[model samples]
Target chain A: MWDTFILNPMINALLMLYDFLGNNFVLAIAVFTILIRLLTLPLNLRQQRSSMKMQEMQPQIQAIQKKYKDNPQKMQEEFQKIGYNPAESLAGCLPLLIQMPILIGLYRAIIIVLGSTPQSLFELTARVYDYINLTDLLPISNKFLWLNLAQPDPLFVLPVLVFGTMFLQQKLMTPATKKQESKGKKQQDDNPMAGMTQSMQWTMPIMFGFFSLQFQAGLSIYFVLSNIIGIGQGYYMRRSMAQLKEEQATKKPAVIKAESETAVASPPQQSKQDDAALDAAMKGTPEERKQYQPRKRTSKRKRRRR
Target chain B: MYAAKRPLRRPVIFLLIIASYLFVACGVQTANTNWPGLSTDGEKVYVAYGPEVVAYDVESQSKTWSFPAETNPTLQFFAAPSVQDGRIILGDFGASGGMLSPGVVVTLYALNDTDQGVPGSIWTNGELVSDRVVAPPLQVGDQLFVGTANNFIMSIDATTGAKQWEFEVGHSIWGQPAYKEGVLYLSSLDKSIYALEAETGQELWQTELSGALASSPVVNTDLVYVASFDNQLHALDIQTGQEKWAASAQDWIWDAPAFADGVVYFVDIQGNVYAVDGASGDQIWSQQLNLPVQTSPVVVGETVYIASGDDLDAENPQGALTALNVADGKQQWQKTAPGPLFTTPVVVGDSIIVALQSDQDLLIAFDLETGGQNWDYLPPQE
Candidate 1:
């Protein structure tokens, strides 16, 4: 499945793109990497939403904890009522999982195309095959610029660039600041992502940088492009976060109306903390977007129960 | 020089690996650049010792004066001195060691009566011994012809060493060329022997031999004899390379086969001698000696001489010089010493001088008839 979905198609596409664009392999790899990032953009967006949803629920979670500080069962029941689950916040991991096969394919393509290294002898099913010549018109061997495709690049420039781009992407994509729990009124303003720490931030870049020195330069170029695209997507998503915030604010007035209806039926006034939360949710245009609509218990409660 | 992308330093290591494998698989040979010249003149023995043409006087049992007449500042003596037309012609057949390239130069020298009786340089040319020449000169009329390491058989002016013409053969011609009335015979490392016109070097035809011919092509009156590493003794037609008849030996036929009155005397690597009727190419007698024979044979009137060994016993090492009766292939007498001589005996008039090399070295002489010890001369330092 990978040969068709990733390897063969990517190889053929890269070859075709190289043929059309003066057969410049380095440039082709950069363009190809961007194309792949664009194709997987939807999955990346869903992962962002999942992270945003988790950040918004941090305050509600704190409130649930305060309401039943001594009763663990009551806290759990309140969490079940609200859309707050620790597991759903891990949505960013899906993009990485989906890209694993694509990443390996890119590695192999760079090894064979840029380094001119053939696949392992065992993987070769036939005695002869068509050569994918990148330097077909060059007078000298496929060595060019400062790199020798036959050997590891000596300049160390490519590896550094690859790691730098990865670090930049990671830093820019970090949206929320991790926060500590408090014994007061709950607020989603507490940074949800500040919890992600430093161990992985430096470790991943160092490990990949070390490997980039040994791998082909072409793959290094692709890696750099992938990171750059990821950073750009992060910026775009962050820029559009204001719209998401507005949508959340617009749904707040209906929440307050329902609370008032509850007061008329069983009680008159509720806790001042709940009033403050509903007011915060209705502070902006959230009140205008909120409308009284029929809620589907089958999809909401049943799905949450499962 | 190597490509920037490719690691060229490893190739030298790879060659070492290859050489080591060959050392274990096949064997190594002692390399000697001094050529011991071969001839059919029956009166004189010519050799190139260092820079001079030295000839041994058959009657006086002493070497004639060394001739410095033929000197090439750039060439070396790769093969022994070939005596032709009362002159000593030496080929610079990679003997100098600097020109690892092929195609040696052939230089001739004549006795200068005015120049203090020293042999004076007459003429020198590259046509005679063109690179990698181990073969002696084959004289046809006024022109002397020989093959080269580059796989070309050429004719040169016997008096001037000027090239007349050339004919490309299969591979490097390591064998000494042979000649008949007008046809020139040559063999190559590519396992093919060719017959060419003496004057123009035009190819008449080429015959495929079993293996490479590294030995000197020995010739009789009617039959041209040659040996191959394929362990085959071929008697080819004098005018064409067509096989007159062929004989087989136990191992690679490396040395030039000696021809006597009516029989062809040759040895195999397995220390066996087979006397074949020269006219019919029939094996009249076969005898196994002590060890393998890689050297050529020396034959006189009714007796044949061969060098054989048994085992490398350090002190004895199975080395001996044996003389056999040609008629019955029976050993007449055996001379034992620290010897496994690689050179053929030079029979000068009544005494035979053989250079025997073993742990020690000496040039020994003996009477031709009774094999009595005459005198021995060992080089002072070496």
Candidate 2:
């Protein structure tokens, strides 16, 4: 069932793409990765939005943690009151979950399409549909740039590019914590979770770079291209969000300006109820906070755009 | 409380990503490693499987000896071992730094029939000829001709294993070279066949075909019969390398054609057997066994024997030795095995020997007259 539904289709599609792209396997892989990214753009956008919302709630979440340091059950109730569920926040990873299988399928497809060995070539002939003519594509020229698509890049250029692009993408996705910058070195050192997140930002790319060194160059090409495309998409989305924020600021300039002045005049005199509500909204699920607070009409506009 | 779990998510996701990386990394290493090829000297059968070449004695129904004695993880043999002058000459697809590494070395080893040591009785070993060797070596006189993944047909001294000459082709040569009367006929993945001088490695004539040739050509007195991936067989004139006639098959012909008494018999990968006239290239009769056949048909007297099996379907995959009358293409007898048969059947005296590409058996012998099981041999389990 897996072969019929995923692997065979991917292999045939890859072969078809190779045929359509003038038998250039490297071009085929690049085009295929771009097509896949475009097809899953909506899912990626949703995940990005969910992540941004989580980042936006970080300050209030930290405030809630500080306020309820001694009351664990109360904190749990507060989190529920704010409508937060840990599981629901993880919905942002859905795009990645969907991409994993496709990536694996593409890897297998590239290997099968290249058909490096006699046995594998025969197996490819069997997997290929009869209508898809690959006679001229037999013994595919794996040479693309300085790499052989069937083998890893000999010059280490692809691995380095893959690492660089992936790191950039990860850097764009991981929201830098302002509290960490404000905290003393000693406090930052004491927080193991913060340390782990920082380490992961570097480790993920290095690990993938290691994989790119071992996998076929064709697959590595896909990885590097997909990472670069993701970075571009991320940048575009971030810019759009920034533009939306600017438009909102312009529309409600007087109200925000007055709040800023009042906030500056007496930082500690803000109402405890307002603080509690903000904390609750931060702890709550994105949907729950949107329902409970209902302060921003732009959220509805954003939904319409999505 | 949710903040407490937030930190755990990163580690979990990290582990999941690492797990997936390891899964794909490990999965890619398990390529299609089985390309079993065999040769027989009428008494002993030599089969190449992975890194070891084992010689099975037909009479004793046991392994006489295996090259290297111990498996070398870097060494992998796919081409059938050519037995001549009491030596086993074969090429290995060697990779350094684990199985996934791209560096491949086609090392040719000539081992004595009976010798065991740490390095184990290798008479002469040649340096790397190419990235890989998938075609069986052809031994004529004192010269050994083997085609390589580097698109070169190399001639090595059979006794000393020294490279004598090399002929570069348009693409990789996956088919064994056929030699006749000072001329060598080679079919390549470049969709062309060339006639080269056996002594000097000079091309005499070349003829382009419709598709890449994956099977070796069989040379008659004046004609060379070769099969290609285009699902057609071409009979070329040996002297001029010109296509004399062409015949179509059901699928890609991955096995060499067998010729005897003006009739040429060949089988495609789809288990469709065709017996064509050697003079006119007309299909005389064809039979379908519904199993994929990678081995060429072996003709012994009036019976044409073929090994057929399907490895793709696990549930009902069948392997059998089907014998048909050469005159009428009628099924004389059929004997079934536990798995696929990828090597050609060799007739040794009264028994027809076949190598199985399955876990249950390594080689099996059947009675030529009755198609009854004589004995089966399995490699020593490690």
Candidate 3:
């Protein structure tokens, strides 16, 4: 079902465009990139929503940490007052995991089939290159300026572009945290990427750049255009998520106490009520805190960008 | 909890594998390992190309006397021609090649004479279905012995193309039948060497080898030399096809074996050409060509000719036909042409005609002594 309904249809559609465009392989790759990015828009929006929610809950989370600064056990308890799970941030990258084959398959399509190297492809292997119209974008030549759409660029332009766009897309799509959690070196070791998720975001582009070195120029073009579209999509979804966060301001604060820096300030009249609730949460079993506590607004903000 | 992730990872891995295989499977024929045609004496030259038969003047460096495969369906050269008794015989291997699956029975044709492009049909002879009768009928007196791709080594009357005898092998036969005295030496993909009674089609004896034999077995009195894909040149007893001796090489030895004086000359696909003592199967000298050498070695008296292809690239594309001194393995002279070459060299009368190929898609003839252009007849440069 997955192959027929999603992958093959998409593959055949790209091929049809390649055929229709007179085998213009470059345009086919560009159109394919645009189509896939557009298809995943909804899922991208949801991830961004989650991230936005997480970001909005940050102020309240900061207050909770200050309140129990010296007591390690209390800080952990106070953190439970507003929910924050670092592992949950990784969930925002789920769409990439789902789209991995499409990305890699398209890369391979450009190399093994379209922009073939004589030394690598062996004889006795059945080859069908007619399926793609690589010649149509004629004057667009697989060679543009210094780029050889056929082989990986030796000048490293394509790969660097791939790397730069990937990092930028990661930045624009992943919600930035207002505060960096600094524990002792021990805490840093416990979560190896303590603040490095953002680093990994940039690292993805660099890694993709290396892949570009061995892959074809047509694939690099796809990746660059895809990231460009993704950035635009992220900004649009971010605005929508910001509107949702504004509406939620009327409701009870939704934030993990440790993450709340501004939302920690509740009305003074409601302080006694909040303190009583905090005492109930403190007395309650850990599982009870997990079940009753609301999701952080910052998590939603994180989700929004995701 | 991780067990749930296992199935999820499986699909990702499976999709990745499928994608990689697809990438490897889709490339085009960006370059030709070669385009081998026949020399004048009806011998297949070079490597990989089949139907190893040629005539001195008719064949170009290209695979066909005419355009091999034409987009125009109506323009078919149904006449497959070869020479016997100074006449060119023609016939079909009784099947369709290229895109179609051919039938089992093949038909053949014979020619007597030609002046320029005009030909006088010497005789019309039909014998069963034998597609690859590439080597002109070896007309030893009256018996015309030839090999066919349809798995038969048949002898026909030199005058009428009537079947005189037939010998069957284990698998389909593609190499030309090498003849000397009353014995006909034949090679088969079945990995067996056969010494057949030239007159009766009776197998004198057969010796099985380790690899498939593709080149026609060249006989020098008591020793029979055959090149096999098994990477070894085998010298068997001429009378019984028994192992006389063998020397292993580093690459696929597809070049036809040639014997002169006491030395044997052969070329490997890696461009290594060798001279070995025919009496002892010991290497005397070895030399490498500029690019891969797939052309079978042809020796006439003191001169041995072999063809070499150039490094196929967007620029500086060319190929060569080299003639060497048989005794010392030193090059006498060479002929260079543009693009990849697979045509074997055939020495006939005053002209050492080499059907050389050009990027212009024409078959050119070069003077044997001077290496100058002799004849340029083909379509314009493609």
Candidate 4:
């Protein structure tokens, strides 16, 4: 099932791109990565929008939790009034989850496509489509610049670039850290999600960069190109989201109400707090923003005691 | 809510690491890179496949001795061992000491074959080359010639394991070089045949073909025949590296054409067997088996022995050894094997020895006359 649906199609598509791109495998990889990023643009945009909305609702959410601290059911009703659902925050990870399969599939494809050994060539031939004219394409050119696409880079150039580009992408995607928040609030906001994302910003890049040391140079090229495309996508999403926030801030009260009803409905009384929360969410660190989030469930005994 | 979300953080990172490792392993692990290399010297057969090379006695029908008493995971032996006198010479795929080392260091081992239990290396030259030796080493007198995957052919002192001279080619050499009349003939993936001086490693002449030559050139009286990945069989002038005649095939011709009775017999990877006149390159008879053939057909008496693998698209892939009449390409007899037969079968006395990549059997022998099983040998796994 994996081969027929994911591997075969990807291999063929890559071969077609190779054929069309003057048989330059590096160009084929770069173009293919860009196309894939474009295809997933919608999901990325949706995830970014969800993050922005969640950031804007932080202060109001904190206020509701404080006002209804003793009344558990009343707090739940107020959360509904503000149209805040904690589950929507998980959507921020959806786009990343979707990319894992693509990475695995493309890795397999590159290995076989640039295969220099007889067994790998035989395996490639078996997976190739009938129309590809594999006879003419028996030996794919694997050289580009100082790299033999089938082997790892000897100069450590690609690995460094992979690390640098991935780190930049992670930086762009992660919410800015808030440096001005009180130490107590910062401690309270040290949630797992924030900590995970922060550590991932370093760990993910370092891990992939380490892998790039042993991975084929062709795969490393893909990693660099894909990370670049991701960085571009993040930039584009940030610009559009900022523009949307600006438009929302300048809108009339009736227009804002209509838009809020369709999206995450916000009470008029909390407008200034929402603005302050948005600023903190957009400019502060993920850990700082996470401090305002309410716990999902409370102990029944604690509620009964209250 | 944050605390509940915290648990997911560790698991996500752990899963990502696990998945990355799995994907990296799938890409980096050495799977089937090449087939087993087989050679025989009348009394015993030498098989080099994975980590070790073993010599099996033909008459005793028992194992004689295996090189390298203990298998080393880093070293792989796939090049056929060239046996001459009491010396067994072979080259390894290559290995390195992890990331600290820059490139792989391939070793050329010359072992004392007279050892009855496990042969010890007489001398090993590991510091000379940094590439995989795919082609079998050709030893002439006290000099040994080896072709590597890095597109270089080197001449070493057979007795001292000292590098004498080296010559670079346009591409990797996968076929054994044929040495005759003080000239060494090599076929390369650069789609050319190179003629180098046996003693000095100097190129006398080179003839460019339309496709890569993956098999060694068979030097006859005046012409040397080579099978090409260009789907053609070419006979080149042994002296000047001039093309004499070319015969076309339906697919890539992988092995060198077997010359017998003024006829050259060869098979393409698409399983098309052909017999062409040696002098004129005119096709005599063509037979289509429509399977995957990578081994050269060996002509013995009135029959030609050909080995082929089953369709790779098939669920349970198998292989077959078919004997065909030399005159008309008529099927005389055929026997099936549990795995793919990629190595060329060697005729030792009355038995044709076939090496397979199968787990159940590594080497199988059949009666050359009747195509009946003589014996099968499976090496002990590490």
Candidate 5:
């Protein structure tokens, strides 16, 4: 099932890419990596959006946890009120989990396509689709820029690059623990997810970098290119999220001032509750967020005209 | 509490990743160890499959001797051993420094053919090359010509295991070097056929074909017949390396064509066997078996034997030895084996010996005239 559905399709697609892409295998790999990343963009965006939403609701979540420590059902109800699903937060790992199969499949595909041995070439004959003129394509060019794609890189350049790029991507994808940074060790103690993500940020890159040391340079090319693309996607997502937060903050000053004025008239404990509620409202629904986005766009256009 | 359990998640995932990597790595490593390389010297047939190289006596149908006596896990032999005058020469695929070293070093060993069932090394070329030797070393009198996977053709003294001369090609040479009248002919995966001086390893002439040649060139007195991945069998001029005529096949012609009595017989990877006139690349007769045949056709007298296997990755992988009339391409008889018969069968006396990919029967002997199985032998795995 794996071979027919995932591996064979991937192998043929790579071969097709190699055929039309002027036989420049490295270029083919780069383009294919970008294409695959684009295909999985929706999943990545969903994961990123979920993570951002979870990050935004962190303070409110902590408040609920502290208040409803004695009432488990009430804590669950409060989490729902803040539009936070713990299950959805766990599903944030889904995008990476889905990518695992793609990585494994592409690894096998690269090994077969850039096969340096006869037996591997022989096995490739069986894996190739009938329409492909494998006779001409026999012995896919493994050479590119002093690197034999079939073998591991000797200069140690790729491994280091893989480590650096993967580390950067992981850093970007990992939700910044602003609360944890401010609160220090106590915040880390309170939120296990922060600790897990931090550990993963280092561990994942180191693990893949070690893998790149042994794996074929072609696979390392895939890793490096994939990580670079991920970095771009991560940068875009973080920028958009930051813009959205900025727009929300900019549009909410008048409402926040009005609430603060009403809170000053009310009791002290009510003022604190109102302030927390205002913060939750600031991290509002997609509808509320989209309303402020147009104003930021208009302001940018006005600045451009100037 | 969640924080305590969270640390365990990464360790579990890391273990899974490591396990998956090991599994994939192990599978890929076993996929292309270059099948069993079989060769014969009229009296004994040598089989080099995995860790050991063993020789089987043709007449007695028993083991004559095996080199090293014990299998080394690191060292693997896949190239056919060149047996000549009580000396056997072969090269290991490679052995690395296990976990510490990243480089693989291949060694060439010259062993004395002994009466004691275990051959001793005459001279060992320890780490002579950094790449694997996929092509069998061709023994020409005192010098041995070897082709490596890393695009190097080496000439080593057969007696002392000393380097004679080394020539680098454009790509890997998977076919054994062919020698004729002090001139060496080699087909490379670089899509070119190279002619080199046997004594000096100097390039004489090179002929670029349409596609890569994985099989050795069959050189007669006049022409060098090269089967290539271009789906064509090219006849090149022996002296100048100019293409004379080419015969097309359905798929890649992976092995050297057999030349006997002015006729050249070869099989494509798609199992199409064709007989062509050696002088002119005209097809005389063609037969379709519809199975993958990577081994060269062995023509003894009037019968041509071809070994074929169907889908090595299949659940019940099967192979056969089919004997056909050399004149008409008519089927004489066919015998099936338990596993894929990848190596070309070697004819000795009245029986033809074939190497199988199965563990149950590593080597099988069949009657040359009749389709009856003579005997089957499996070497010691230890």
Candidate 6:
């Protein structure tokens, strides 16, 4: 079922591209990867929107965590109220899930198409569709620059490029804030999620680079090209989201200004002591403010009990 | 609400990445060590699989001896063993520490009939070539000719295993060399057929074709028949190396065309059989079997036997052997096997022997007239 639905179709498409591109397997792989990226652009856009929404809610989520430090269940409820569920935010990876199989299929297709050995070449003949003419493409000249498409690059240039492009894509996809960047080991220990995220950013690229050094150069080419496209898509998506946010902010500035004025005005009508306490709470650190909150509420409850 | 489960996502992503790597690794790291070249000399049948060459007695269908006596895991053989003057001559693709190595030198070994390794019988031993040697060595008189992945054909002294001469071509020579009189004919992936002096390795004449030639040239009298990757078979004059006529085939021809009784019979990789007139290059008859054929057809009297495999079933390929009438291309008899037949069938007296490309049995002999199974031989498991 996998072969019929995924592998065969991918193999045929690659072969067709090879035929159309004058029997150059390298060109075929490049074009096929681009086509795949373009085909998944819609899904990727949706994923990017989901990611942007999560990024936009990070500050509110941190505030909620600080407010509910003493109430674990309330913290969960507050996270739900703010629509900040990390698990649901991971739906952004759906596009990657879809492309993973295609990437693997493309890798196999490159090997089969290159037909390095006699046995592999015969297997290629079997995989070829009847409508596709592969006679001229037999014994595919895997030569592209100094690398043989069938074998890995001797100079390790492709692997380095793969790492470079992938790292760039990951950086663009997950933009860390300046505070997170300046944070030391102690800060990372305090926020375990931040540490894991930072580690994955480096680890994934290095692992892929290692794979590029081991697998055929043709596959590495796909990886590098695909990452570049992903980076471009990420940039575009982020830009479009920023533009939309800017437009929305522009349309509602007066309304936001009115709300802020009203909030400030209401605090002064509570009482002199209450106004001073509110000012101190607003100026204090998150931990100090949370401590101040429980003390004020406990005093009021004790007075009510007496 | 699901933020509490965020800790589990990292491990899941890690597992998915590992799974993707494993999936691609499995597909890319397939066994590239097939193409078991088989040859027979009436008394014994020699089969080259992986690195070892085993000889089986034709009558008893029992193993007689194996070259290198002790098996070496790294050794790989792609060229069929050529028997000449009580010695088995074949080429080795050499060994590598792993698949990532930039390939090693190709060695030609000459072993005696008793399976004893001859002293100093390794020609160009440890000598690095451009690539591996997959073409079978062609033995002529006291000299043996073999082509290398390095795009050079070398002539070696059969007795001393010393290099006599070498001829450089435009591309790698994957097809075996054909000898006639004092001239040798060889085809290369460079889309050209070359004729050279067998003794001096001097190029006499060369003819350019439309596609790369993967099959050895069949030299008969004044004409040479060769198949190419361009899905066409060209008949060339032996003296001038000029094309006499070219017949179009359904697909690529990877096997040499068999000539018998003024007719040439061959099959394409797509299992299309064609019997063409050797003199005029006119198609006598063409039959489509819808299976992939990598082995050449054997002609005996009025019959042409071919071996084909259902390539879709990669794990357990089913092979079909069909006999066609050489005169009219009519089906005579058909037989099926559990595995694919990648080696050509050999006719021994009244029995036909075929080697299977599978894990279980290596060889099976059938009665030529009745198409009945005579016997089968399975190699002892390691």
All candidates: DockQ:
0.01, 0.21, 0.02, 0.22, 0.19, 0.18
Clashing pairs in 6: none
lDDT of 2 by residue, A190-291 (tens): 233344545667787877776775678899899999999989987887788878767867987754443333211111222466556656755677644532
* Candidate 2 lDDT, B121-226, residue by residue in tens: 4554536474578888998978889898768898887877778899888777888898889999999988999999999999999999878888889999889999
Sorted by DockQ, highest first, which candidate order results? 4, 2, 5, 6, 3, 1
lDDT for predicted candidate 2 compared with the true structure: 0.75
Best model number under lDDT: 5
Q: Report the number of backbone clashes for model 1.
A: 18
Poorest stretch of ten by lDDT in candidate 6 chain B: B115-124
Candidate 2: how large is its RMSD? 7.3
- Quote the chain B TM-score of every prediction: 0.76, 0.88, 0.72, 0.92, 0.92, 0.87
Displacement of the residue A187 alpha carbon in candidate 6, Å: 2.3
Give each prediction's root-mean-square deviation over alpha carbons.
23.0, 7.3, 20.2, 7.0, 8.1, 8.0
User: Docking quality tier of candidate 1?
Assistant: incorrect
What's the number of clashes in each of the models? 18, 5, 79, 6, 0, 0
- The sequence of per-residue lDDT tens digits that candidate 1 reaches over residues A182-241 is 321111112113333222354456556655655555666778789888889878887788
**Pairing residues by index, what is the TM-score of model 4?**
0.83
Which is the better candidate, 2 or 6, if ranked by TM-score? Answer: 2
Residue clash pairs of candidate 5: none
Off by over 4 Å in 4: A51-94, A179-189, A248-306, B1-32, B99-103
Better of 1 and 3 by TM-score: 1
Q: Write the per-residue lDDT of candidate 1 for residues B89-115, one digit (tens) a residue.
A: 655433221211111123433222221
The CAPRI classification for model 5 reads as: incorrect
**Model 4: fraction of native contacts:** 0.16
Q: Among all windows of ten consecutive residues in candidate 5 chain A, which has the lowest summed lDDT?
A: A289-298
Arranged by lDDT with the best first, the candidates are 5, 4, 2, 6, 1, 3
lDDT of 5 by residue, A190-240 (tens): 455665666667777776766666677898999899999989988988798
Q: Which residue pairs show collisions in model 2?
A: A82-A284, A83-A284, A83-A285, A84-A284, A84-A285
Q: Candidate 6, residue B78: CA error in Å?
A: 4.1
